[model samples]
Target: MAKTFKYAWLSKLSASSSALLFHYFPLRNLGYAAREFAKQGLKPGELAIISKEAVAPYERPALSKAYLFPESPARLPGFHVCVGSGGERLLPEWYNEKGIELILSTEIVKADLAAKSLTSAGGETFSYQILLIATGSTVIRLSDFGVEGADAKNIFYLREVDDADKLYEAIKAKKNGKAVVVGGGYIGLELSAVLRLNNLDVTMVYPEPWCMPRLFTSGIAAFYEGYYAKKGVNIIKGTVAVGFTANSDGEVKEVKLKDGRVLEADIVVVGVGGRPQTALFKGQVEEEKGGIKTDASFKTSVPNVYAVGDVATFPLKLYNELRRVEHVDHSRKSAEQAAKAIKAAEEGKTVEEYDYLPYFYSRSFELSWQFYGDNVGDTVLFGDSSPESSKPKFGSYWIKDGKVVGAFLESGTPEENQAIAKVARVQPPVQDVDQLASEGLSFASKI
Candidate 1:
């Protein structure tokens, strides 16, 4: 006889892709945009978000800053601990209050491009006159190096709430008090800075010789690297995590590095990168490992279906090509595009291409850095190289054929940033650094 088992699941809703619908994680900024759409009294339709993390999409920046607040000591809490229920994300009840319909806790299993419909895991089907898919990303996990106990409690990944909490608790309780961060990418550096500020002995290992090789220039990276080193964070460059050793109780005791040096640690936090969730996507949408390719209008190769967020590697007018971005702004912008397309299509209008500037922000040791667009071309920089705080705290540059690409400066100064960003975009002819600096926005005035 089969043993009795019991479980409960949330109720489900289905929608026609043609209906006015929106999709996104409940608590994320995407919720703000969706609430805007609901202002139109959109017809309730099938909307879904396949978030791999259990928590509603709360702000991720808090994961590292939570302990600093006076409210609580550093402790490892599960992903959902901070995020309010579906309420935090504006769940169906919220939609009902706003006269909008949203379907949550349901995963979309397949998209019927020909029929303009999507299927849920429970076999529920929604034919979309319009649809939006906003499931975001899963963190790229570390591979065990086959060393015994490499998978033990001392090792942790920081993708979800549980991951950050576990690492935080472990770091606080360490006897010898050592921590090793295996990557110097955006997430890794952020966590490493937090750990160092907390008075923990932290060693951050970076494969690339410089910090943020993908985002910042060598000059800026060198400055930040030195700054971090001065703050007691052992900066390890061009190295890798090779192995781990267990204590007498079988818990991981040390992290062995490729340089034959072992970092005695209470815990190891790995923050490599993140990728879109397409592992189970078997639909007929033209796709790549990066994500499903959407046209300028956010439509996929499949007719009647559109993809958004980290999953849709959509086209960019600025890049003049297709690109996949992982920024939080990209998610909001992409969702808005798909929403506009749906709203217009329901009214029988032609679709327009979605063009958006990529933006992301990070905090490192009291310094605030933000990027407006991808400035992958030649870079010209202006700033005092000295790490001392008394100097001017602004750096501006021209990227991509002298297009205003980026700027880093003290926070709470939006007007100055806007002016510099305007100059960066003008592609102003530069006779010399002094000339460009003294007379700003000669080119911008033309626009």
Candidate 2:
């Protein structure tokens, strides 16, 4: 719950005002910067660390991939990964000597804004000159979805370490080896791919017409559905799992669909969606659609207290309410800005406003993809997929008010996305990109 700060674990030192880091890595890109602050001359006691997870800050994405394929864990970029055998271990060797307090197994229940103090699940209270609230989100379970035998042996949500562990065990133990993953969202499809990799008979069910229906256009969504089906995963669309019935052994054996057909299965993975972990901060924070509302600096209606990661939902200058991100990258970006604002205010300097482009990256099978800016809404297409044939790449830009608002470049590093981001981060340019494309000029050059 409430522990002390230690800093010898830091690979290097910054020494600014000791900071209290919340959540685990990669979001701690904030703490990485805090070390830079330390070298600039802040004291060792100026830093503190806290996390609710019992292990090192590992990537949640892996739970859906690598845990099923042992070799996948070895392929991660060092700086981009997290988690110790237990959880996010900032590592005693890294910061123990710096006097930055390390508190694990503790939960920061609420931020007492005016009092400059925080309350924790341990019932212990601590005061902070400055604080960071990096509490994240939780998976939306299918228990309330009229799913019978919801607690049956194989019904699970793929979110936390335990969830991943359960899924791995279920896949490994299924002697008949028939696995069903409910919902066709990003997490669902990715996890389905993981199960298929192990040669398991995997089937994914979604109520929509295509996979990733909420994110991509119908054409793109169809491409994905076909792509996964080709890889040996049976995708059942336009149907919902209205009711389920299991065997006497409390095992999930049959899934009944609204179409009045029953499909047999050995296990099921649920990834319908997720909601913010706002119960702890419920009445104390301003919220809409169940997420914290914050301004540029992540400042809540209450002062000196800030919220980041999945729990906070703020306006994006470029997308308006159009952007409500819950990705790992968005969390880190927002936390870094929030941390800097805290640091500047400490030195009696004017805080720099927080403004950033929203982005998300995921590997679907062998394809590596990254998206920036508004990938949805009033979309426009550019380039030709016919050049590559079987694995064609698509390029398109999102327009608003006659300006290039956001762009999506499937495949590659989304170099065009990076270019348009500079302009999209503030406001859409007045230039007419559609006209430019009509003249045979590439979107990259126009940006």
Candidate 3:
């Protein structure tokens, strides 16, 4: 005998002894949280996942990475939940096997915290004993800033599957055409490289003096910017896209820069930033740092309700301050923590508090970099960081109060990367800056 899952729009439902998860964007954490529930003694039919996407929970980072590859692009079921973290690939069948109801493409229009009910746009209501909010973040759009002609065709923003599909179609339609990428953040750098790989004439524009200024120091940016330049990407820094011109077909034609330079474009991509999707729970939950504030357990102020992923502003035990991380790594960990806390509470047991070590990484054409811990304080560049190096291998360390507070590595081996991660977590003290630079990866390995 098999159990059938109920669709959200088909009928009203109640789960008096169950947990319900609501998520948008990436649901990798949601998948992990469900697994944790089952592993911690929750029975069949005790959990459900609600998402607006038609597909099951998958690795959202793939949308910008392998998904855009010109050859043999990544597809669903392959990059599904948990795969990004080297876990089992959780397909829709996995949910069925686990008796977890997957309510896909169901948008929850209203939420009643007191009633513990969520109403769908189709007029169906669902009630739950426990709620997990993992709504993630929404991409910031140029239209929000009143950028003229932002509504034109062939101007894309990659956030969801639908957006990626559209961009893929444009890539095929406008092969070997010119592309102007706006904003020099993660999407800007990655997309510029990807477009160039597809043989598109690519140009990157940013208002900052360097790309990825939020994390990359000038020295680190120099290597990447120079590499991009060598790859035939025109780097336009310290300027912004002010407006756009469209053809009669409503396709974007030209990008008007604030510096008074107009770039002819067959396609355009913007990656300014994203905002946490906490608007629905604004008055219902405690918020700090533009995200839903949670404890170390990822439990919100609301009883029996938890928040995770990009929407959560939890205590960074290392820094002793509340912080919101918009990366996939934190999202995955927070989701697991919330699930553990819920199950532990039921059994009158406890789990360890989350003490997260910040990690961020990016991958471009023949280049990959990983950063751990905070990027504040004085930085020391090490190794051959030159863009012209045949085999570029370099790293940087952020020293604060004579302790190695952060580490960034490029072209590092598995053991070397682990060493850097350990250094960041241990916060090893350094007596000589010159020695540390010269020693480079050796210093971290010895730590």
- Maximum-lDDT candidate: 3
Q: What is the lDDT of residue 286 in candidate 1?
A: 80
- Per residue, candidate 2 scores C-alpha lDDT tens digits across 111-173 of 454665555667765556555566566677767664666777788887656667777777778
What is the lDDT ranking, best to worst?
Answer: 3, 2, 1
TM-score of 2: 0.82
Please identify model 2 stretches exceeding 4 Å from their true place: 1-42, 70-92, 108-122, 319-323, 382-390, 413-441
How do the residues 28-137 of candidate 1 rate in per-residue lDDT, one tens digit apiece? 53353454455534544333333323433355556765543224644323222123222344543464564333344555555455655556667765554444545456
Q: How many clashes in each candidate?
A: 17, 43, 0
My TM-score estimates for the predictions, one after another, are 0.79, 0.82, 0.96
Better of 1 and 3 by lDDT: 3
Q: How many residue-pair clashes does candidate 2 contain?
A: 43
Higher-TM-score candidate of 1 and 2: 2
lDDT of 3 by residue, 51-96 (tens): 7777777888888888989999998878988887898888888888
Candidate 1 lDDT at 432 equals 62
